[model samples]
Target: MYIEQLKNKKYSLGSYIPIPLGFILLMFFNFLMSDGVDTNEVIQQTISMIGVNLTFVVLVGPLAFGLLLVLFWVKFVQGQTLRSLTTSRAKVDWKRIFFSFFLWGTITTAMILVLYYTQPENFVWNFKPEKFFIFLILAIILVPMQTSFEEYLFRAHMMQGIGLATNSRLIPLIVTSVLFGLMHIANPEVGKIGYIIMVYYIGTGFFLGIMTLMDEGLELALGFHAANNLVGALLLTADWTAFQTNSIFKDLSEPSAGFDVLTPVFVIFPILLFIFSKVYNWKNWKEKLTGKLIVTNEIDTVANDSKL
Candidate 1:
């Protein structure tokens, strides 16, 4: 039913081309700018002048770019509603958003505590009253915008568009997931932990993708991603992490592929999936994930045949 909405003439597969075309235009501008001045230098210069806590604000840049383009294309070009882009439900469910946010936030905070207590030597208290509050304020305000951009773009916008283009659920799921993961290749974590970190990134993409498909919406994915980044920025800090903010604690140890990384990918993610499936009353193990979307004339044909 979610994918079936693509049958609207305005959302026809042909209109999907503008989504990538817009992104390419944005990328071209980014590249042209990069040729003249080192973007990293500009960032570092800004950080040196504005203090490192504002780095989170700086990090929101690319997400902002992606968000603007997607919003314009979806709203103007495709003439789509935000509710349709986000969910099968008639409205955007704020309750579901906060529920998944707190659920994953609690789980993530618990996991962080487990690691800190079990490996006390690997962490240090990094709290500074002034700096942390500033970081918290900035993170609270700006971080959702960052996470929202990613979820809406990769999970909602691209996922739905690609699904329409391919006329199959499976290809879009896999494509968006891979793109989501590969998009993170520039993250500092990848450099610190190597490609093995991709397991977590790609696995996260899969987790989010499955949740989207099973739930018939992006609300859960939105909350989960917001919590994943927001809580991490608030509770933890590390030099190797993308968000090297002033957090309550700093990870002193080097980045590595370990239970912390693998457990979520292989263990906890599956458990969460099972829980979500039970709660959402999702049926059809094979069809929803891989079935061909039967919108357009197929429904008309069925209706006509039933008249006999």
Candidate 2:
């Protein structure tokens, strides 16, 4: 039903191409141009030059613009309401968003604390009140924009686009999940921990995609993502990570692509999915995720006039 919201004739492939294609090309070129350069060194140098907060703005600000772009395209080009782009419900569900955010935020913070207590030597107290508060403000403001841009692009927009074209939920789920993973190929984590980290990234995409399909809304995905990035930014910073922020702690451990990488995808994510499924009362696994989409004429008309 969420994907069927895009079944209107106004939702043309040409309309969908430019924004996502431009984003993918930008990432590809950034990866290509940074091929031989030491990305960590570059990040360090940039942080040194501009400080952590400004460097974060430099890195993440465009994604806010990207979020605006996606919303604009959905409204003007596709002639759809923001609600339709986000969910099939009568309105956007703020309660679901907040629930998912609080749930994941607590889990992530607890996990970080467990690690901090378990391996005290690997972490340093790097919390500077002045710098941290500044970074916190920026993280609170910009991090959601960055995460929301990704969710809207990969989970909502591209997922619906691919589903509209193929009429099969499984194809879009797999394609978007893989594309979402490949989009992060240039992250410093990949360079630090090797390509095996891709399993986590791709698996995260699958997790989020499955969540979107099962929940029939982006609220859970959006909230979970925002909380994950925001909490990570506030709590920890590592040289090998993408967001090397002025956080409460700094990781000094050697990066490894070991059990940590596999655990999330293989263990924790399935558990989280189970929790979300139970909380949301999700059903019809065979149809919501992998079955053929059947959009009646009435659904198409309603989708078309959603802007009215």
Candidate 3:
């Protein structure tokens, strides 16, 4: 039983409790530290919010709220080694990450290209070499923080918590996937594209969740996500997109949902999944994913004694 694995594996719930709470406190600290304590400081508020999120990403490992929580669970709670936390003791698969990064990157770039070709005048072609290079450097440093923060929160902390709580794979998968989508509701893209685009956002969560659950570790998901955001932030920028930092290209093209929108959700995602499944030789996914976690007395007995 998967739940039994939690106990037999010495997994504990205490580690999960503080991470989300700590994140909330960190966010409050960010809000309090922001400049101008007024009703309408939009720019300041935005900067502070981004700052808080990125800070959380950087601290996740050190603070045990993000990737750190996963490490804590494997190391202290489960008494497992570091290799278990990172790769589930399996070989790191670089091809999976590369295939996903390029595949998704090309799909997004193609959409921008089509839009640009159709409406050249709409796009300013504002490529300033110096500014764009500066943006690239910032992205190399910060976007990983952003993507890692979200992944650690959703896939690492929340996924593990729900998996332990419900003692079933399906509930955690659904809960984390939905929560991950909700977390992105505040991004500027949502307003421009309307709530309909949430299907894509939430769908991406589901896809990532499937990857995590199937892989039994965050390595592939981490690589894929880091690559996705890093490439996107560096490759193009649009007026409507959030994080309007300098990039190699400014998307002068108007954004709209087309086959481009559906390709990732409907096509690329499934292909990536198939690719991973084959590479990992993932078997009995239904069992590995949806099976119940049966908590046993063996590990819990010792865990309970530790409290005394």
Q: Number of the top candidate by lDDT? A: 2
Candidate 2 residue-wise lDDT, 203-270, digit = tens:
99999999998888898899999999999899999988889999999999987666658988999889
User: Per-prediction RMSD in angstroms?
Assistant: 5.6, 3.7, 8.1
What's the residue-level lDDT of 96 in candidate 3? 53
User: In model 1, which runs have C-alpha deviations exceeding 4 angstroms?
Assistant: 21-49, 296-308
**Model 1 RMSD in angstroms:** 5.6
Model 3 off-target regions past 4 Å? 1-7, 21-82, 90-99, 106-122, 257-262, 294-308
What candidate 2 gets wrong by more than 4 Å, as runs, is: 297-308
Candidate 3 overall lDDT versus native: 0.62
Local accuracy by lDDT, each model: 0.78, 0.87, 0.62
Q: Would you estimate the TM-scores of all the predictions?
A: 0.86, 0.94, 0.71
Can you rank all candidates by lDDT, best first? Answer: 2, 1, 3
For candidate 1, the per-residue lDDT at 162 reads 86
Model 1 lDDT-worst window of ten: 299-308
Ranking by TM-score: 2, 1, 3
